[model samples]
Target: MNKELQKLLRQINDKKNEVKSLVNDGKLDKARAAKEELKALQEKFDLLFDLDEEEHEGIEDKVSRGTAKVIGGEKADKKNLVKSFVNIIKAGFLHVEPDEADVKVYKDALTSDATPNDEGQQGIGVTIPEDIRTDIIELRRSSDNLEQYVNVEGVTTKTGTRNIEVDAESTPFDNVDEAADFPEMDEPVFEPIEYKVKKKGGILKMTAELLEDTAANIMAYINKWIAKKTKATRNAMILKVLNTMTVGKEVVVSNLDSLKDIFNEQLDPAVAATSIVITNQSGFNFLDKLKDSDGNYILQKDPTLQTKGKLLFGEYPIVKLSKKTLKSKQILAEDGTTVTGYKHPVFCGDLKEAITLFDRNVLTIDINDKGSGMWEKDLTGIKVRDRFDVQPVDKGAVIKGEITEVVNG
Candidate 1:
């Protein structure tokens, strides 16, 4: 070994140690200086290592993974396992918890080397965050009548492209004094303003480990949502899914890849059975096992399967359900909550998609009779606001106001 070459090798190792200390101390400036020194030392190393004829391609060593992976098992999978993984992502702990990775690096004055944290030094000046820059092509803008969807990744994937109506137009308000006399009042002339906005995004890329953590977070949130929605829908969807997989009353996994990994089917059925039992012991599927054939639909024994018309208050609907399905009944939703089926099931019928509707009774105002003691029977050509106040409600509607004095023959 040449004496000079050995000295340069030792210098590189010392610089590597200095970079670690600087990074650990959160001294980004000193760390950068140490990194530059290491880069210079690497050039010298290349010359020395290349003294012999190189038989390889342009790049010497190949990276197995594009990015790093955080692995953890039995001993260290504690309550704060996520934190441990993030510690590796950041290459070390920081004084502040930056909301995003790039923000953390920027606040710590990160350079390319400070990013990927490769070679364990401040890293090569790779703009880690600015890797996936994208631009939006705004196809259309919202008008007074309808609006179109934006072509963002999440929107396109989840909602698909569709023309949707939106209340994007803003109404102009005119100053009005209700206390003043009608002659002096300025009837606030109203108009709406319509406009649109476009969005531009910066580049974004993530380490494999970072992406896994993010995916885990999204899964956790979605699972929480599924749990809450399960109750609201009365355990309808997931219960149905679970029941399809269950044999008799017990949950039997006919096929599960993760389960196969843990215990082979050839090993023992008891282990798999026990695992399924414990997994489903959450009481979440209690309603699922209860079937309509046993007569427990809607939690009422001998429950009426046929839909019935609402008999609001003491007055009952004049129609009755026949063996034949009701048709041509218009579904209406006013209060926008509790929906009921009218002549037909307003919620479900020949409709392509599942939906709910509410019935809002139409109001007709009659003219006041002589002396205003009674109202005229005629109700025609009356403006909605003139004859009566039409108040829309979920279960029932309300109509209360002064009748028009003029009656139409």
Candidate 2:
């Protein structure tokens, strides 16, 4: 066959293999897309093959004038020619037998300008399908997603300010005598915090060939990757704010009285009632092993709900973070040896009142394959942008406590 016809046939075979692979893998959605592409390629190949045959009509007639026989000994017309070609291709894919007329036409087409293989065999190009699984494996995200603890405020503008009453609790109205002169009272002080949404994103470039040939949903995969990245970014930002907050009280994990003081004396009664303990794995390990004078574990399961897991002091909920997410610090011991210490932050109190996330609530995605550089390189660029800001709101509402090894100097 001519070079163009040969190239078209190769594409058709490749597409067929792709469809079979996707079906075996259980990726039905991608398999459907591949099947559609395969059908278009097959149609194009048929059209090109018909044109090629027409160009060699005289040679074809000479070769098939007597030997070629239709189903009913009828002359092979244009309709039969196309039908026979399609039937041969379908029979090859389905592993079934085609009509005698289709087999005769298929053999004639293969002999017309065909090249010999390495084994000196002609008309031998077939793809065998393989088994594939349907599900995709993905990385697990950090369980201590800090966004769930903090307050999220959606804003339309890029920059804005929020006013918080700083001393609302401290400044209270004084009782006035009946019809007597009112006592002078302190006015509530407000602190204005400014917030500007910061943009974070990245771009992924892929080859045009992979986009067309791959059985997986490339766009969906990219989108899922972006979502994961954005979640990690937000988690880091929230932790940064929480780590920098002023500590209301520091409690030594080994001292049971100090831990009790955190709730009774350090934090307000109302705040302590709705408090939670946030710590890393190492910190949780220490608390989990703590025992009362009775030799019973301090960190007991929630009495109200057994399925709610263990709680701190059987009162406050515990939000255990992974070591990677919470991070650790290097400290010098008294002997001048460096040691890794996980700063298990025990953030007790109302977390929502401590931090606020100003979210623009807009995630923009732009895809470009027509740009000059991209077109020349045959690459498609997928760009994503996420806008949000994390800031401390009521610092006093959350008290920070660190559980770490005693650094002897």
Clashes of 1: 11
Q: What is the TM-score of candidate 2?
A: 0.56
> Which one is best on TM-score?
2
State the lDDT of candidate 2 residue by residue for 106-185, as single tens digits: 43333111121214212222211111000111231334667777899866456778899986767778898898999877
Looking at model 2, report the run of 10 residues with the lowest lDDT sum.
Answer: 128-137
Candidate 1: regions farther than 4 A off: 52-409
TM-score per prediction, in order, is 0.15, 0.56
Q: Note the clash tally of each candidate.
A: 11, 2
- The all-Cα superposition gives candidate 2 an RMSD in Å to the true structure of 19.0
